[model samples]
Target: MANSTALHSNITQVSVDSNKNIESLRMAYLILLVLCFCIFLYFLTIILSVYFTTAHIRENTRYVLFVYMLINDTLYLVLGFFLVVFNIYVINLPVPLCIVLVILSLTSFMATPYYLAVMSLERYVAICYPLRHAQLCTPQRSHAAIAIIWAVGFSPCVADFIALSSSVETKYFSLSGICGRPMLIKTPMQNNMRYITIIFSFTMVGLIIVYTYIRIMLIARKLSSNKSSAFKAGKTVILHAFQLLLCMSAFTSHFTETYLKDYFAFFPITNFLLLMCLPRFLSPFIYGIRDEVLRKYIIKWHSFAITLG
Candidate 1:
């Protein structure tokens, strides 16, 4: 009897220790999430403020597209953060509300690569056809392009909703559940659509980026007078390609989680932070710091703010 009681005591102690460790890890994850979000939010505010207040920046087609990307990323980040929190807390949300949130999230997610491709094309035009760049890339045209991007991004969401409506009962939309893609996308048709759309979009964007890079590089080598500008544009396109790859990796996150689950129990959190969050987090820095005009204005505004502080 004494031996059995001792064994029970040891088992109880182990269970308590395990619970404490899990709670500690959860707290740490939450702290990191909040910290990263705050930092990104702060930088986004500064960048967007600069774009909004400056007439020249707002008028330029490149800056206009950049600002739109920033806005889209902000939406994605906010939605993603909320969804992560909801999942962490195991909160049940209204099915309709969750569907709306997921739709917006997916739309914003799809828009990123499209925006990057457009931005690369802009650079390509600016360098490959410098004489026509001004006429080709006006603010009005940029705005129209943005509208087209939104339409394209939301196309998948529309199709998915239709499939969902047909596959599930009317009451399904009325029920409450955890808000996530997996929770809502419950049909084989939805899965196939997702895979097909992702593959097509990524492949097309990859081809566009690669084409632009090669053309810009060839142009850079040919003309001595325009060599510097062409080289700079080539480098910019290369960065865009890198960013696109980062965004693409988010699609493979499920595979990463599946393979590494046993080896690293916190792989989901790690994968989310690294794949989804990090790409958006790096955007402002990649474009803002590298673009000479924006970099100059950012520094000036930063200094002025520091003086006032």
Candidate 2:
């Protein structure tokens, strides 16, 4: 009787272990699948922006800035996806390749918010100072502004890479996860520098967005007596603010994933999707659908389809 009972116990234990292993395997692939789907959505957003946008709209500085943003987001999605797949499959990556990936990922992450802040400022100028907007926001200046955004966005990563420890023991795959290149915070100075960069960049941009919107609201209210145009301007202002909030969510999610590691149950997977891809997926929808000319085209297209049916 004792021998028979032990045999049954061993069989149950083996079954449980098998089930756990299967579940783990399913979860691993599920994350990779999700990342790929997000990348597809990013590509779709870019295509819609390019195809549906009117030539006149494309010529506008604001729209140009947006197109640049979409392009950056696409690059980030592709590069970040590779990193996720590599990390998941435990593919061995050389140190130089790892560093390059980290630089690109960080550049994308940092560049996006600056663009958002600039966008909000553009709206504020257009609504608050309509007469001088044409003079102030010329395409040449916009190009210069974009150049500055890239320069500032990439400066920190360059600084960090220069400061990276020469110690071979500190170099490990454990540092570079799917979400971001490892900070390699080996020294107290490096750790402090990271904190300063995050606080200055994100916090300053957040403040700029908030301040500009507040100013926009005050100006809109003062001009509310105009009724029709004020209503339209107010609506546009609100939409832009919504876009900023969406971008902010991505920023915060990334910080959480990187810093508050213990709190997330599945580690990088949930944080990666919410922080990294969610903005890329949602930004174009918010901007594209709200575009006046694009909306007209969409309505006409829908009417044509219905008539054909």
Candidate 3:
């Protein structure tokens, strides 16, 4: 009787209509849209606040890093907005449309990890040596460094695109939506590369933690400055690491499902929404509360604008 009941439940699930499935997907996207909009507002608030209150804080290399991060946050949020809207509303489009959206989506995701890595290193240096920091971190160099980060970040997307183009139809599933996954089991080479990514991600997080603690110790030994700076750095790195670590685990689990189950059982859109929305919301909160300059600017700009009105 138990076996029969389980079979009935499975049969009911399989018999669900596409329209109902599509409606459920639409609801999911609506929730994601709200999350994306929140990120947009957060990024916009930072940009506006910074621009309006330029008198408060001069543009230094540290500020430049913050601005770069703001730009990336905006790009990520906007891309996410379009991704959720397009996939949910349109549902199906020409196959080429999928390719175009795939490229844009990948452009955001690929670059984000690298930016986190860069920010980790930046914090490491800022905390490690106070005197040499100005020379070590310059706007010209930071911009160039970011450009390099993007270049390296883009290579994987480029290589994978080339691989997709060159592959025969028999090997894998063709791109059907804004995002697609490899249907076949990963090659040994592919798994090796993913493991490398996992390693590098952890290494970046490790450096952030070690340097943060070391900076704390240095500050303690000399009693040079208050503990707040090191505390702020520690919190930021921890948040970023938590997001990236969760994402890495999700990627590994999704791809590593062996032969018994469907490789593509999960909805790509749903998984992405679940993984990303919380980070987007949390990032702006961290920026506003933790960064004194950002916090002051946000308040002052709004106050001044209201007074003018």
Candidate 4:
């Protein structure tokens, strides 16, 4: 009786351990798969939409700023695709590759918020001071602003690249033929500086939206005679503001995922799809039709399609 009881207890303990190991493995795979799938899908959607949206924009001079926006976004998506795939599935990207990936990833993250700021400021000026709009917001100046935004985003990446290139390999994997590179070589100053840029960009964007919306609301109430124009302008402003706030929320949520969650539960796929890629694609559906010409074109396009069908 004693021997039989001990045998039964041992079997039960083994079964429990097996179940625990299986759960752990399942969770690990889920996290990895989610991260990989989410990033790939996000980048794929952004690149396609960016390409198609800007392809027919003939007036290069007028569309230079938007071109810059698409270019940076394209670069971001392209780079993000590789890093997410390699990091999760392969898990042993080479040291040099890692450096390039990190540079690209950081560059995209830095570039994103500034473009949002520039976009908001452009809308703010267009609505708040239409009299001086032509003089102050010419195509030449727009191009220059876009250039400056990109330059600011690039500066920190350049510094980080210098830091990364100097890193010595800390680990190697013969089977994968890959090596790990140190992440940061800078002190508090560089770290603080980079984050400051992000904070400043997002803040400037938010400030512009808040101030402009308040002014628009008050003006709309007073100038009720220009009600149609005011309504259209107000709608546009709100849409822009909505777009920015949603994007900011997505980014902040992603940052939170790093420390607040466990390794395999990132769910980068679901959050990023809903938050990041969806917004970019969705904004076009909302605002592209708001443009008088684009609205007409879409209507005509749909009619043409219907007739053909």
lDDT scores in order: 0.89, 0.69, 0.60, 0.59
Q: Could you give me the TM-score of model 2 versus the true structure?
A: 0.76
* RMSD (Cα, Å) of model 3: 5.9
- Candidate 3 lDDT score at position 103: 58
Each prediction's TM-score versus the true structure: 0.96, 0.76, 0.70, 0.66
In the range 125-228, model 4's lDDT, one tens digit per residue, is 65667687768777678778877876777787777655544543444211242222223443555566666766787787778767777776677787747556
Worst 10 residues of 3 by lDDT: 177-186
- Which of the two candidates, 2 or 3, achieves a greater lDDT against the reference? 2
Better of 1 and 3 by lDDT: 1
On the 0 to 100 scale, the lDDT of residue 54 in model 4 is 53
What would you estimate as the lDDT of candidate 3?
A: 0.60
TM-score for predicted model 1 compared with the true structure: 0.96
What candidate 1 gets wrong by more than 4 Å, as runs, is none
Candidate 4 clashing pairs, residues 3+ apart or interchain: none
| Model 4 misplaced stretches (Cα beyond 4 Å) | 1-68, 163-190, 251-256, 259-266, 299-309
Q: Write the per-residue lDDT of candidate 2 for residues 1-309, one digit (tens) a residue.
A: 999999999999999997687658648755665766665564455445554556776567777777778777777877777776676556766666687887888788778888888877887788788899889887778889989998998898788876774534654634544333553444666667766986788778878777777787787678746545545655665665665566666656656766876654455656566667777766666665577765565566556657988
Which residue pairs does candidate 1 place in steric collision? none
Off by over 4 Å in 2: 1-53, 165-180, 224-265, 297-309
Q: Whose TM-score is higher: candidate 1's or candidate 2's?
A: 1
- lDDT of model 1, residue 108: 95
